[model samples]
Every structure is written in structure tokens, then in C-alpha cells.
Target chain A: MLEYFEILGQEVYKVLFLLVPILVSVAMIVWLDRRVWGLVQKRRGPNVVGPFGLFQTLADALKYIFKEIIIPASANKVVFILAPIITMTLALVAWAVIPMSEDLVLSDINVGILYLFAVSSLGVYGIIMGGWASNSKYPFLGAIRSAAQMVSYEVSIGIIIINVLLCVGSLNLKDIVLAQKDLWYVIPLFPMFVVFFISALAETNRPPFDLPEAEAELVAGYQTEYSGMMYAMFWLGEYANILLMCAMGSILFLGGWLPIIDIYPLNLVPAPIWMILKILFLFFLFALIKAIVPRYRYDQLMRLGWKIFLPFSLIYLVLTASFLFYFDKLPKGNF
Target chain B: MIAHSIFFYFFSVIAIFSSLMVITSRSTINSVFFLILDFISVGCLFIMVGAEFLGMILLIVYVGAVAVLFLFVVMMLNVAEQKQSWFVGKKSNHLPTGLIVSILILLELLVVAGGWKYKENLMSSSTLILSDISNTHQLGLVMYTDYILYFQLAGIILLLSMIGAILLTFRKRSGVKKQSYFTQISRNPSSAIELKEVESNKGVIIDD
Candidate 1:
């Protein structure tokens, strides 16, 4: 009994260790995203809060805590409350298998990438529930748009991941990172990486692809009826999801936790720091994209995903598989 | 051992409870939500049983994609007004026939399961391999090497079905100026631009 309790306690501790940093980083990334956005637009963002507005998100979080939560009378109260919780929980849960370094993950499961993909795919449900539970037209419209968008993009994202999986011959994320010791997948699979990044944007509902939350038309989309801490939970969950995508981008393409080079000074740095830096670089690009690009029209977005990305990735998948087969360089460890 | 049993029961109980909720829920949308929960719990059960790849696929494909589509349709339907029980309501006259057919199918499924005994003489007669590799690898080995032809046939069937769906939905409207992405993208500056020089007194005549 004592031994079992010890194991449970250790597991709990490990989970907390992973989660606390993730939550803190989510807060930090929100500020980073804003600052980067501000930089692109040539303005100071939230500079009144703390040093360079470092504590803006913290202040916002505190404000959310003290505000009154308004639940619409017609709304499905249970689902409305459950929506943000589900979003935040699912977004955070996907991080369990994401390796920060060689062994910094909370749970190093065999099918880590599939687990991530599954959790991320399920993310649409939170928004759908929120939109439907709001019992309003705009939210419903937003939910409908997001449902189609996410489902469409996920097809291409699956194919892109398959391209990476083919070379590594493993669904394990750590193995994927290590497989890039000599050459990162970004070199050979550059087009797939771009598509994956774009899909990630659509998946997370960031700007340009954020038709679900297009402020111009939908007010706040699924979040229109949410208020107080409930609203804050959605915001936190969104940023965390963006961060997760950035982490995935770094892991799949840039090589998670691997230093830029194997030289003396580069090798001296810790592995997780490299991972964090790559994530930040990708996050920076995401911020820049929000500032620079105009939003795509709905039809155009679908065309890009289905008409272009689907066929492109499919052809690349076949080519990569055939090439590997012809060369007999397919990973021997695979069946 | 005890913990494994506990998890197994935990997931199975939730699965059964949620599946019951899926049918009994008053709201259609809520029923779809419960169905999603059912998928998730069943997926958890699969993962607990060591078929992690299949478990993840169940989560990704069914709970993520299929259930979302179900929820989408349910949401669009005036769900607040839909309180019809499964056994009753106007169009439910066929329910009896449906139940009979479903039960027959269930019995056939049972027969299919029991007929696996004859697989002892097949090439991959060993049902489960206790190999050190992951379940995905084990599945790939059996699926690709032994049943490659059947797999290819299944793929063709799925492709045909998808093409059929598109064909059924696709309509041609004569007046609609649909965006021609191919022509749009293929236009180079030389092809699209008319570098016409106009004389000072005579302007170039525009042609439609």
C-alpha cells in the first residue's frame, strides 16, 4: 500500500512539475505574442503594466478573477461552463508526451505524436460546445465555420506528419528529434513543414485562419457569451494551444531540443533551452504572421487546404516512401 | 495488477454509462456529446489494453472527426425542440424493422467472431504476437505483408465511395463564374499584361 501510494505521489509530482511551467509559459507567451504583434505594428503593447509589460497577462489574469461571470439565461449553463474547462484541460494534457529535452517529458508514451494529434483534433469540440451552448446565431455560425475549417485542415496535417513518420519510422516524438542528428527533416520536407505550420495556424484558430473568432463578423465567435474567468480560461487555452503548435513545429522540423550545431559552444548549452528557443522563434513567426497577413477568404482557405495541400502532401508521401524503398534505407526497426 | 483492473473497470463503467446516456439524453445535442464521451471512454479502454495505436486512432478518427460531424448536424437541427424518443415519434414506424435488421447483423457479427477459429491454418495464424515491438509495428507487419491485397482493395473501396460522394454533391451552374485556380495561377505577366503604347493624339482602342 505504501509503495503504491509512493508511486501515485511521484506521478502527481511529475505531472505538477510539467504543468506548472507550462502554465507559466502560457502566461509569458501571451505577453510575447502581444509584444511581437506590437513590434510589427510599431507600437508599445501593454507597457503600463510591468517591465516592458512583462506582467500584463498576470494583471489581466487577476482582473479576470475579480470580475463577475455572466451566464445568459437561455444558455446551457452546464456546457457553457464545461467548454473552457475542456479547452484548457485538453490543451494542457497534450503536453504530457512533448519532450522539452532528452528526458524532460511527463509521460514518454510510445504513440506520443498520435496522442498529440488526437488531443489537438478534439480541441474543436470545446469551441463547438461553447458556440452551441451560447444559443445565439453568431456563435453558432462561428462554430459551424470552425468545424469545417479544422476538419479540412486536419487531413493535410495528417499527411504531413506521415511524411515525417516515414523517414523516422516511429510515432515516438523523441525518436523523431533524435533521427535528425545529421539532418533535420526541414531540409528534405521543407514544403510539408510550411503546410504543417499553416495547418497549425488553422488548427489553433490564429489570425488569418481565425474565421471562427473573426471579430469583424462574429463579435467573439464561440466566446461571445463567456465572461470573467471563463473568458480568461479560453484565452489561456488558446495561447497554450498556439504554444503547443509551436512546440510541435520545433519538434517535427527544427528538431526538438537539439542545438543548432554540434560545435563546442553550442553543445555546452542545455538541450531544453534549445527547445525553448526554437519554440520562441516559431512563436515569433506566428506573431509576425498575425500582424502582416490579411485574412484569407473562406473558399480560398478551403481550396488551399484541400485542393493544394492534400494533393501536394499525398504525392510527396508516395515519393518519399518509394524513394526509401528503392534505396533500402527505410528504417530497419519498423516492421 | 490491481491498478490495471481498477483502470479497466473505471473506463468500462464510464463507457457503458455514457453509451446509455447517448440513447437516453433528452436533447439531441447532449446525446451527441454523450456519444463522444462514449468514444473517449472506449478509447481509454483500448489504450489500457495495450493497443495504444488503435486506441489513438479510435480517438482521432471517431471521437475527433466522426463525432464532430454528428454534433454539427445535431446542432443545426432545432435541437431544443427535438425530444423524440428512439422507440416512438412520427417517422419511427420503421424502428421495429431497423431493430430486427440490427439484431440480425449483431448475430452475424458473433458468427464472424466465432469463425476466427478456422484461421489456424492461415499464413498469419498466430492471432497475437508477443513481440517486443509496439502494437503499430505488429499491426503493420500483419497488415502490410500478409493482407496487402485486401488492404489495397479496402483503399480502393474507400476511394470509390469518396468519389461517389463528391459526384453526388457536385452540381454545375451555367451562370456561376467559379474561380478557375489553374488559369488564374498560370497567367504570367507576359500573358496577362497588354503592353500597348498609345500615340500622343490617338488613344488605344480597348477590346472586350
Candidate 2:
């Protein structure tokens, strides 16, 4: 019984260890994103809070916490409150399977990638529930758009992951990274990498595909009715998911925790630092794309997902499988 | 073992309660939400029982895609205002039949659960569950080798359904102006533009 309690206590400690750093990093990333956005627009961004706006996110978080949460009179009270919590919880829960370094994960489950996929896919629920529970037109429309957008992009993302899986022969994130010891999958699977990145943008509802929150039309989209902390939770979940996507892209394509070159001085650095660097690089690209690209029209967005990316990824999958079969490089397993 | 049993009971109880709420909820949207809750609880149960891949698949496919579809249709149809009383509504003529079918299903499930212990040969099945491999790897080994044909057939069925849905919803309106990339791109400056000499007090007939 003592042993059992010890194990449980250890698990809780690990969860806190994983969660606290992630939450802090998420806050930092939010500030970094604002700074980047400011750079793109040629304007000073949030510099008044602290030195170079280092504490802006902290101040914002405090403000959100202290602000009164206003529930719409006609809203479904239970679901309205539940939606933000669901979003925040699901965003944090997916990190259980994500390895910060070789030994840094909370739970190194076998189906780690699938667990991530499931959690990310279920993210639309929060949006939909929030929108519907708000009992308003814009939110309803936003929910509908989000549902369609996420579902469409997930198809191509699934195929792209399958392409990666064929090469690695395992769903484990660690194995996927280890398979890149010789060469990152990005070199061999460049087209799929690009496709995956764009799909990730859509999946996270980032700009250019953020029709769900297109401010000009839907008036903050699904977030129109949300206020105070509940509103902050949605954006918090959004940023967490964006960071998660960046981390996924880094892991799957850039090679998680691996140095760019396997040299003497390069190899001396710790693995988790490399992972963080790659994630930041990918996030820079995300911010760059957000600044440059215009929002896609609804039909155009659907067309890009269904007509272009889906078929391209499908053909790529076939090509990958055929290449593996031809070269006899398919990772062997005990069938 | 005790912890495992406790977690099992926890998930299963939530699953049952939510499933009951899914059926009994007055609001259609509420029913859909309960259905999602039920899917999540059942998925937790699957993960707890060592079928992590299957559990994730259930969460990703059913709760994410299928339940979202239900929510979309429910919200779009504005069915929240049309809440009907359970088994007592004016148009509930099929309630008796529904009750009968549900009871029959419950009995069938109970029978299957009870009969599992008597099936001594079940342990000697050809496709033995391997302990060393992950569930996904085991599934792939069996599926890609022995059950490839069935898998392909399922793929074909899904493709057919997709095509059928597109065909059913597709409509080509007669008067709507649509962009044609072929024509738009093929036109050159010479064909699209002309500098015409105009006679005094006469308009240029550009079409001619």
C-alpha cells in the first residue's frame, strides 16, 4: 500500500513537472508571437509591461483571471462553462505522450502518436460546444466552418503520418525520431513535409486558414460571445495547440532532439535544447506565414484541402510504400 | 489489481450513465453532447483495458468526426426548441417497437458476456495475441497479411460512400457565373484588347 501511494505520488509529481514548464513556455510563446507580429507590422508591441514586454503575457494572464466571467443570459450554462475547460484540459493532456527529450516524457506510451492525433482531432469539440452553447449566429457559423475545416485537413494529415509510419514501422514517437538518426524524413519526404505544415496551419486555425475566427466577417468568430477568463482559455488552448503542432513538425520532420549535424561539438549539447530550438524555428515560420499570407476564401480553403493536398498525399503514400517495397527497406516486424 | 478494478469501474460507470443520458436527454444538442461524453468514457475504458490504439481510434474517429457531424446537423436544424417528452410525445408511435428492440439488444449483449467463459476453445484461436508487440503492430501484422483483402474492401466501401455523397449533393446551376481557369489563362493581350480607330461622331463597334 505504501508502494502504491509512492507510485501515485511520483506520477503526480511528474505531471506537475511536465505541465508547469509547458504552461510557462506557452505564455512566453504568446509574447514572442506578439513581438513577431509587431515586427511584421513595423510597430512597437507590448513594450510597456516590462523590459521588452517580457512580462506582458503574465500581466495579460492576471487580467484575464481577475476579470468577471459573463455568461450570456440565453446560453446553455453548463456547456458554456465546460467548453473552455475541455479545450484547456485536452490541450494539456496531449503532452503526456510528447517527449521533451529521450527520458523527459511523463508517459511513454506505445501509441503516443495516436494519442496525440486523437487529442488534436477532439479539439474541435470545444469550439463547437462553445459556439453552440453561446446561442448566437456568428458563433454557430464559426463552429460549422471549424468542423468542416478540421475534418477535411485531418484526412491529409492522417495520410502524411502514415507515410512517416511506413518508414519508421512504429507509432511510437521515440522510434519515429530514432529512425531519423541517419537522415531526417524531411529530405526524403519534402513534399509531404510542406503539405503537413500547411495542414497543421489549417488544423490549428492559424491565419490564412483561420476562417473560424475571421474578425472582419464573423466578428471574432466562435469567440464572439466569450469574455474574461473563458475567452482567455480558448486562446490559451489555441496557442498550446499551435506550439504542439510546431513540436510535432519538429519531431516528425526536423528530427526530435537531434542536432543538425552529428559532429563532436554539436553532439555535446543536450537533446532537449535542440528540440526547443527546432520548435522555435518552426514557430518562426508559422509567424512569418501568418504575416504574409491573406486569409483564404471559404471555398478556396476547402478546394486546397480536398482537391490539392488530399490527392497529393495519397499519391505520396503509394509512392512511399512502393519505394520501401522495391528497396526492401521496409522495417521488419515480428508478424 | 485493486487500482485497475477501481479505474475500470469508474470509466464504465461514466460510460453507462452518459449513454443513458444520450438517449434520455430532451434537447437534441444535449443528447449529442451526452453521446460525446459516452464515447470519451468508453474510450477511457478501452485504454484502461490495454487496447490503447483501439481506444485512440475510437476517440479520433467516432467522438471527433462522427459526433461532430451529429452536432453540426443538430445545431443547423434548430432542434433544441423541439424537445419532445420521452415516450409520451404525440408522434411517438414507434416507442413500443423501440423499447422491444432495445431490450432485445440488451439481452443479446448479456448472453454474449455470459457465454464467454464456456467457450474453452477461444483461447486456442489461430491469431494469438502476442504480449511483446504493441496492439497497433499486432493489428498491422495480422491485417496486412491475413486480412488485407477485407481491409481493401472496407476502403472501397468508404470510397464508394464518399463518391455517393458528392454525387447526391452536387448541382450545376444554369445561371451562376463561375471562374474558368482554362479560358482565363489562355487569353492573350491581342485577343483580349484592341485599339480601334473611331470615325467622327461614331462609336466603335468593338464586337464587330
Candidate 3:
């Protein structure tokens, strides 16, 4: 019993080490997102708070915490309360398997990528539950739209992952990164990388594909009823998810934690910094997309996911498989 | 081993309790939610028992996709007030049939679970549990090598069902206009418009 408690305590400490940085980065990323958006529009955003408005998100967070939480009388109380918590928890929990650098992951399970996929796939429940529990028309519509969109895009993402897996021969994230030591997947699998990045945008419900929360039509969408800390939880969860996508893009395509050049000077830099830089670079692109692109029509989004991405990814999968098989470059699976 | 049993019992208890709630919940949405909980707990049980691949697949395929669709349909149908208690509705005739079906299913599951002890043929399969490999690699090896035909058949079955679903829901409405990007994009000035010399008193007759 004493040993078990000791193990549990150590695990808890490790988890806190991983999660604190993640949470703080999430807060910073929200600031970064807004700042990027503001810069795109030629405005200085949130400069009133601390130096360069770094504390803007902090102030906003405090406001959310101090505000009142009003649950509608007609809403389903249990589910209403559970939705945001689920959203935030699922969003954060997926970080456990995301390796920052060599041996930096919380859980180095063999099926790390699948675990991430499953968790992200389950992320829909939060939106669905929140929308349903709100018992409002707009939220419900938003929830339905999001549910279908996530499911559709996930198919292409799965195939895209399979494309990388075919090359790496293992589902381990570290193995995936190490496999790219010779060359990053973004070079050869360029089309799939583009598709994957776009799908990541859709999966995270970022703008352009953010029809679920289209303010023009659906008001605040699934968040129509949430306020106070609950609303902040959703906001926090959204940024965390976006960061997760950025990290995923970095890991799969750009090579997680691997230095851009494996030379003496560049390789001397810490691996985790490279990982963070890559994630930030991807996030910058994501923010750029949000500033530049217009929201997709619902039918247009569906058509892109289904008619274009689905077939495109499928054909790429076959092509990659045949290319590997013909050249005898396929990963000979044992380990 | 003790910790293993503890986790096993914990997940099994949650699975059983949530499945009970799935049947007893007043609202259909709540029932679907409970169904999702049941799936998650059962999936955890699988993961705990050294079947992590199967567990993740369960979470991904069933809990993620299947149950979400169930919730979507139930929410959209506005049947949340499905408050008619089991065995109270006038259609209580289903209770007898339900009980019979339930018992038959229980027996079938029991056979699947305990048959290895008694049935020689069932234990004769060549694929023994390989300890060295991860579950996913083991699955890939067996699935692609030994059970390749069966796997291909499963894919065919899934594809056929998808086609059947689309066919079932497909409708042809003549009057409703649909966007055809191909036709719209292919249209050119030469094909779409032609200039004609007009007679003095008449506008150009537009019949092609």
C-alpha cells in the first residue's frame, strides 16, 4: 500500500509538470491568437494590460471566473454542468501522449497516435452535449453541424496518418519523429500534409471550416448558453485543442523536436525548444488562415471533405503503398 | 495482479451500472449518453486486460462514431420526453419477447466466454497469444497474413452496407435546383451567349 501510494504520488508530480506548462502555454496561446488576429487587421490588441498586453488573457480569465453562471430553468441541469468540464478535460488529457522531446512524454504507450485520435474523436461529445443541454435552436444546429463535420474530416485525417504510419511502421510518436530523420514527411508527402493541415483546421473547428460556430447565423453556436467560468473553460479548451493540432502537425509533418538541420550548431539547441518553435510556427499559419480565409458554406465544406479530400487521400495511400512495396522500402514490422 | 483485478472490477461495475441506466433513463438522450458511458467503461476494461488496440478501436469506432450518431438522431427527433416507463406502456407485449431475446443473447455470450474449457475444436486455432509483440503488431500480422480473406470480406460487407444506406435514403426531386459546379464552370460566352442581328421592329428571337 505504501509503495502504491509512492508510485501514485510520483505519477501525480510528473503529470503536474507536464500539465502546468501546457495550461500556461494555453493561456499564452490565446493571447498570441488574439494578437495575431489584431496584427493582421492593423490594430494593436489588448495593449492596456501588462507589457504588450501579455496579461490580457489573464484579466479576461479572472473576469470569467468572477462572473455568475446562469443555468437556464428549462435546460437539463446534469448534462449542462457536465459539458464544459468534459470539453476541457478531454482537451487537456490528450496531451499525455504528446512527446515534447526525447523521453518527454507522460505515457509512451505504443498506440500513442491512436489514443490521440480516439480522444479527439470523443471531443465531439462535449459540443454535442453542451448544445443539446442548452435546449436552444442555434446551439442544437451548431452541434449537429460540428458532429457531422468532425466525423467527415476524421476519415481523411486517419488515412493521412496511415500514410505516415506506412513509412514509419510504428504508431509511436517518437518513432514517427525519428523516422523523419532522413527527410521530413512534408517533403515527399506534400499533398497529404496540405490536406492534413486543412483537415486539422476543420477538425479543430477553426475559421473557414468553423460553420458550427458561424456567428452570422448560429449566434455563438454551441456556446450560446454558456457563460462565466464555463464559457472560459470552452475558450481555454478550444485554444488547447488548436495547440494540440499544431503540435500534431509539427510531429507528423515537420518532425517533432528534431532540429531543422542535424548539424553541430543547430543540433546543440535543446530538442524541446525546437518542438515548441515548430508548434508555434504551425499555430502562426493557423492564425494566418483564420485572418485571411472566409468561412466555407456547409455544402461546400462537406463536398471538400467527401468528394475531394476523401478520394485524394485514398489514392495517395494506394500510391504510397505501391511505391514502397515496389521499391522494397516498406517498413519490415517486428518491433 | 491485485491492482489488475481492482481496475477490472472498477470498470466492469461502471459498465454494468451505466448499461442499467441506459435502459432505465427517462429521456432517450440520457439513455444514449449512458450507452456512451457503458461503451467507455467496457472499453477501459478491454484496455486493462492487455487488449489496448481493441480498446482504442472500441472507443474510436463505437463510442466516438456510432454513439455520436445515435445521440444526433435522438436529439434531432425530439424524443427526449420518451417518458413511458419500461413495462408500463400498453405495448408491454415486447417485454416477453425482450426477455426471451435477452436470455438468448446471455446464453450466446456465455458460450463464447466459457467454451474454451470444454470445446476441443475452439481451442485448436493456430494463433496462440504471442507475448513479445504489441497488440497492434500482432493484430496486423495475423490480420494481413492468416485472416486476410476474412478481413477483405469484412471490408466488402462494410462497403455494401454503406451503399445500401445511401440507396435507402436517396431521393430524386425534379423541381429542386442543385448546384452543378462542372456545368457552371464549363459555361463560356460562346456556348452560353450568341449575338444575333436584330430585324428593325423585332427583338432577337431566342429559340436555339
Better of 1 and 2 by lDDT: 1
What lDDT score is found at residue B70 in candidate 1? 89
Q: How many Å off is the CA of A189 in candidate 2? A: 0.5
Give the alpha carbon lDDT tens digit for every residue of A252-320 in model 1. Answer: 999999988899999999999999999999999999999999888889999988999999999999999
Clashes of each: 0, 0, 0
Q: State residue A333's C-alpha deviation in candidate 3, in Å.
A: 5.5
Residue A47 accuracy (lDDT) in model 3: 83
* Model 2 pairs in collision: none
**Candidate 1: pairs in clash:** none
DockQ of each: 0.61, 0.59, 0.71
**Which sections of candidate 3 miss by over 4 Å?**
B84-89, B93-100, B113-130, B183-208
Model 2 regions lying over 4 Å from their true place? A333-335, B84-89, B96-114, B118-130, B181-208
TM-score for candidate 1, residues paired by index: 0.91
Error of 3 at B168 (Å): 0.6
**What would the per-residue lDDT of candidate 1 be over residues B18-126, giving only the tens digit for each residue?**
9999878777878888899899998887777677899899999998899998888887786435555443454767779989999999999999998776644122212
Single out the weakest 10-residue window by summed lDDT for candidate 3 chain B. Answer: B120-129
